[model samples]
Target: MDFDYDLFVIGGGSGGVRAARIAAAEGKAKVALAEESRMGGTCVIRGCVPKKLMVFASEYPGLVDEAAAYGWEASAGAFDWPRFRGHLATELDRLEQVYRRNLERAGVTIFDQRATLADPHTVRLADGTARTAKHILIAAGGRPVRPSMPNAHLGMVSDDIFAMPSLPKSILIVGGGYIACEFACILNGLGVEVTQYYRGAQILRGFDDEARGLIAEMMRAQGIDLHLGTNLVEMAPAEGHPERQPTEFDAAMGMPASDSDAAGHAAPAAPRGAPSGPIWVKATNGSERVFDAVLFATGRAPNTPGLGLEDLGVRLGRNGQVVVDAYSQSSVPSIFAVGDVTDRINLTPVAIREGHAFADTIFGGRKTAVDHDLVPSAVFTQPELGTIGLTEEQAREAHRIEVYCTSFRPMRTAFIDRPERVLFKLIVEADTRRVLGCHIVAPGAGELIQMIGVAVKMGATKEDLDRTVAVHPTISEELVTMRTPVRTA
Candidate 1:
């Protein structure tokens, strides 16, 4: 039963890299990993690292305004996109090198090519070579998918935002998810005219209703033209603009043929690196407008296509996600999958935990399993949102609950006559007095939730929180001081 390696990881993302590193360094097993694109995958390369930097960059203008309100002499200036983008590229490059160095130090072999399942224990690479492993791990992660519509390819995905040659003067962002909302806020903060279209009644659909409502209100106040109950109907390259012509790179990037090209007439390919032109879009609400750019934050799909998993009898979900058990083991005994590829809690931290647990179970002999329940998360909107456990709607359905809620302008903003408000809500089970959920909408909500999450994870009761002393003059102190139930269900 000799094999190429003890374990072969199909992705070099946070999940796959952790598993590979642990198996090699701690488990004392031979490991190897293959990554077609960048070594750090989505989080470091595009998703979180770059996005968070942009979030930081976008916040400076507000900080400058707030500084003036605080009696400090400060003025805002235009953001230089090229300067910031260049720094971001350098940071990403440094991070990728770190990932590679970590894997090498762990004694894991690196393959800079696409890898696919050849058999239960074999992987085929893009270069017509195959390798066998005693165990195979699939953690190829997911990709942002454009909506299936004509001229949709002209629109950029979240990944493309970091690479734009220059910021658009005005942009149309489509979708209601966190990605869409975050970008809407980011672009708006960066001085872009941002129009957001979501077919849903409200944005951040799965979040706490009150928190999301407040966020929607703030987004509009911040000058994002957010239009709920609306969606893009028709889009095309605006006529009379030869600069809007499609290019060979666009075709290679999966842009479909135009109507003229599909009707047996091929349009000339624009030169490489040509700046994209304006897009004319008609919405379902009977409005038409031209935008400098269109960004589709619609959704993402698992990286399963052409992997040859189903052909080898591996079970896959409707969304092309690999189906795995409690320990991340796939239907095939020799195969395993983790991260976004499994469609379970697609957050980067969750993926890392899953990967570590998989390695512990398979190689460390620890038999660890990830607890997916009550995971805390944050959405980095203008005000930020942090939540853990159930939403109020979700908690109300299953338990007799007491909701402790409060909303008011914080001292920092209130002192300056700013209208911004903060909300703190706790959903507690009436009988047990146990906190069922916690949601916060304010600056630093993400940092606040992480500390609060520890208590919630330890099964802290409402009484337990109340007994704790409040940190005076701090907004989070309200978490402990709220004594009255706003409502009981």
Candidate 2:
């Protein structure tokens, strides 16, 4: 039986939605999308959106403390976890409705049930309803990977933690990635005791060494129990892993990477600038701690399970991410995979671009592939870290890189009486003079790094950076005015 539509999309997340909407609006194709959960997908429902809101809620905790240091004497502050949770609920509700309206407007028939490929072109719903299309796409995205501590099932991943019924008094995060650092800052800032446990030398392993150092110093000062060079041996009903229960509990993860190869296979290398280990971690240091709650910011795995990729012989990387060519297609031509599922560039915007490129190739007759280089990333930790292009470590390995690094207190911090300083670094190629990377750890590095990203992406050179007029009275001006290189090989 031939399918009804010209295009069918699975996993209605950022990538899925864009592909569906674009294919429908511009092409002569009918489209339908299937997702078990709400249409908003991971970024909107659990990943970015909710995580950021929680971050926003947590930021206030520092302000409350800063008030006192600035000579404003105020009463003790209290955190209303319930109130904060309520605000998140309201916002989630609004976003869900918006997603449905957008889909309806785009003429996408959304199936609110689990979808799997019964065959190459046929997708089956939970109710046994079947739909076939000329082309099929998988955009199921990824999920958090829990740590391998004994009885670690009790801990929460980035996804499940948001749905936690009650906020724990203290959180012990096990990992040294972006999520690990972000949560440490968030929980600590919100007045919840946070102890970060990482089994590596530094918290952010692959990030610029200086940025990682600055973050470590600030987090320790902010009261986060920074544990480096240790890991959890086990987890029990109690904080100390005592009070053994006779009843059986499912372990979230099977074993340590060294013990069981992380669930029957070696784990993939974490993100670039990531410490030498997995992601969900923002950095590294081999260590351990105990707390009221243990959360895994270890990393995420691609969502390729039950999507029928195995049955169809779709190629996969060692980490189980679907293997695709530069054009984002599976081994089977009519079947396409994108986003975290492909693990090419697992970012919301990156996924969106893949979707557009896929749709363009299929519908608009445009031949294009998403580029991984010159990609920019930001970690939402306090004094957030943002960077684009090469890190000094990566540049040193890839090219004869030159580095220009600086550290200065932010203007606001200068008067605020805190000793923390904003740190920045620039990496450039020694030969071509092209700017290879830019990094900043500061108040609004997320915003400031964008312009530098534009500069580095366009093959900006040392001379280009030197000749550009500095915008006075701004932190960003430091990029253009940086006259000397700190290190060169």
Candidate 3:
């Protein structure tokens, strides 16, 4: 069949770019990609890249303290948000250009506009042009969702963080997921008075219970006013004159005078005559406080709406994620979807692999399928968490398991009298002795677990780990040296 292009990709995210490039360069298929925003999608422009930079910035205060404790003269000063933000913006711009250059070099046509599926093999762009393709790929990715409530638009989501003009003096972070907790830590480190309200009993739901518990405890210890079993009852912008003076804590910390009349207040309150800006939140625990900002890190949903897939008889899941077969093929043979838009292991690397596999299978005749199992992931908290494979809870339910776990203050923290602790855990099947999972909670756990993930993916047994020689004075050595079973089930 004659078509405008051999392949048309509906997004410019990691998945879409990879698929478009591979199909054009390696498979020699004519490819066209459309992106409404910056060339690099979530991971590059907003999600992982910017967030990790914030993580590094947040770590400096602690690193300075640790340095002082180690007999080196070190200290951290106030963070200059404007300066750092400018640099970050430049880096993102450079990265976006790199994505553009890569696509151009691969001989893929770029459409800097939104494209939606007009039919199984047809795409309509925002410019009122329709094009037909032999194959269509949807990698439109997901977006953060704010709560459904009155004035919810007044709050910020993860996407808004990069664009905020200035850091808030105080912020109320809502939710318990990694996004919420991570921002709580980041803002707190950056000198914002942070208060987090989570409806759940603990943060980082779906992770190891013990590891997440320790994280919650550590967050509290680090001065995040974390409130669990609590949620927002109602919220409104702070309006009218101050009924009471700003507390001594506020005054000492340089917050605007709470008692000052609307005309004379120095702190930026919600505009005096308007019902916008400073927020008054009433939480479920019978507490009402006004914060400079409220950040909703509640959740994200698939970016499948308005793509015209539903009208074309393409199946979608409950979350509006495109339902696809193992080969990333939609119900219609010529259509496919991958990455967060598919809601399967929504990591950037995973998306890249899925896109590559799709290109190989359909264009290169390589017949590849992405291995979704045993993919390693890291959460960039103050003490990062690196995990791969099943949790202890999941392992126990599937088969008899032996758990090896240890938690202790690392040597560096011990020297500084810091209360920080690291945890190492291994979940093994009792019958076969194969390591079912490895989870680490420590400063560099993310890097360590990447190495451990390779072994676990190769089906390495606990005995294999034990046989590896331990490196002296290293926290990761604990992974190999733990011989006794902490628990058996």
Candidate 4:
């Protein structure tokens, strides 16, 4: 059947853009992409790029102190948020333009508006325009979701952090995931009083336990008020309202007492002329404090609402993610989905790969499917974390495994008497001797994991790693030098 275009891509995120570009340029198929927001999606515009830049900015103050320890006179002044934010805005604008130009060069038509499925092969833009296509690809990505609670809107999410006009003097970060932990460290390094609340026993769950424990310890040492087994009970605006006073009954329940009026009664509402102020949060642990802001990195959901997918009989998961086959094909033959919207490996690179594979299969006449296993990932906290393959716990559950681990202060910081330490661990299948997982907790772990990922993907065995010569005086050298098994499971 004749169509407006050979392919119509909805949501100009990393995945959608790649699919459109590939289908148009390589497959010689006409393509069009519509994006309601910026062209580069979460990774380029708001998530990775801006967050990493903030990570770099936050590190300087700590570096200045480290320089002082190294016999150099260096001291950090107050962070210039306005200056940095302005520069960040400019950089994001430049990146968005780059995405547009690349798509245009690939001969993919760009629509700077929202588009949603109207039928199996039709997309309706925000305007009253309907476009038909031989095939449609959905890659709308995901969004941060506020918790289902009272006054949850008072807290900001990860995306809001990039556009904040000013950094908060004190922030209450809520969550146990990478996003929450990273920002907790970022704010703390920038000299903000960072109080983190994670209801879980440990942050970074599903990671190697030892590594998680070490990161938690380092975060606390760096002055993050990380509270595990704790969560927010309630929060309200702290203007004119007297703080909740603690009663003897509260003390008996192990709740901390308030320093303010100890009347053991509820505070009155804000008065008419009361000046605006910070947030008053009461946690499950019975501690109450005021913070200039609250950040909720609780979770994210796929961008499927109002997209008209379910109306057309597209299968969606419990979390609103598009359910797809190995090749990213949805229930409808003419439709496909990828990226965070599919709830697969939700990394930007993974999405790009999925998009490329989709184009290759449907348009280029080369059937392709993305291998979702062993994708390397990094969490950009103060001290970064990088992991590939399975966690030690995951490996132990499935296979007889040998674990080799090492932890010590690196020379650079150890020389300065810093308390920071680095951890390197490898989980190997006992029978096959192949490395099943690698986890590293240290500076530049992200970069290191990328190189190590190649070896692990190629099915490198423990002996192969051992045979490689160690790079002397390097933190990563421990990866090759560790011979004795820490434990067998």
**What are the models' TM-scores?**
0.95, 0.88, 0.93, 0.93
> Residue 397 deviation, candidate 3, in Å?
0.7
Please write out the lDDT profile of model 4 over residues 1-489, one tens digit for every residue: 899999999988899999999999999999999999899999998799999999999999988999999999888888888799999999999999999999999999988999988899899989989999999999999998878776665667788787766666778999999999999998898778899999999999888898889999999999999999999999866644465343321222222223224563433322211212366899999988987678889999999999998999999999999999999999999999999999998899999999999999999999999999889999998688999999988898899999999999999999999999999999999999999999999999999999999999999999999999999989999999999999999
Overall lDDT per candidate, in order of appearance:
0.90, 0.77, 0.88, 0.88
lDDT for position 470 in model 2: 84
lDDT of 3: 0.88
* Model 4, CA-based lDDT: 0.88
Q: Write the per-residue lDDT of candidate 1 for residues 260-343, one digit (tens) a residue.
A: 465755344322223244778999999988777788899999999999999999999999999999999999999999999999
After superposing candidate 2, which stretches have Cα over 4 Å from the reference?
67-76, 239-290
Off by over 4 Å in 1: 239-260, 263-275
Which number leads on TM-score? 1
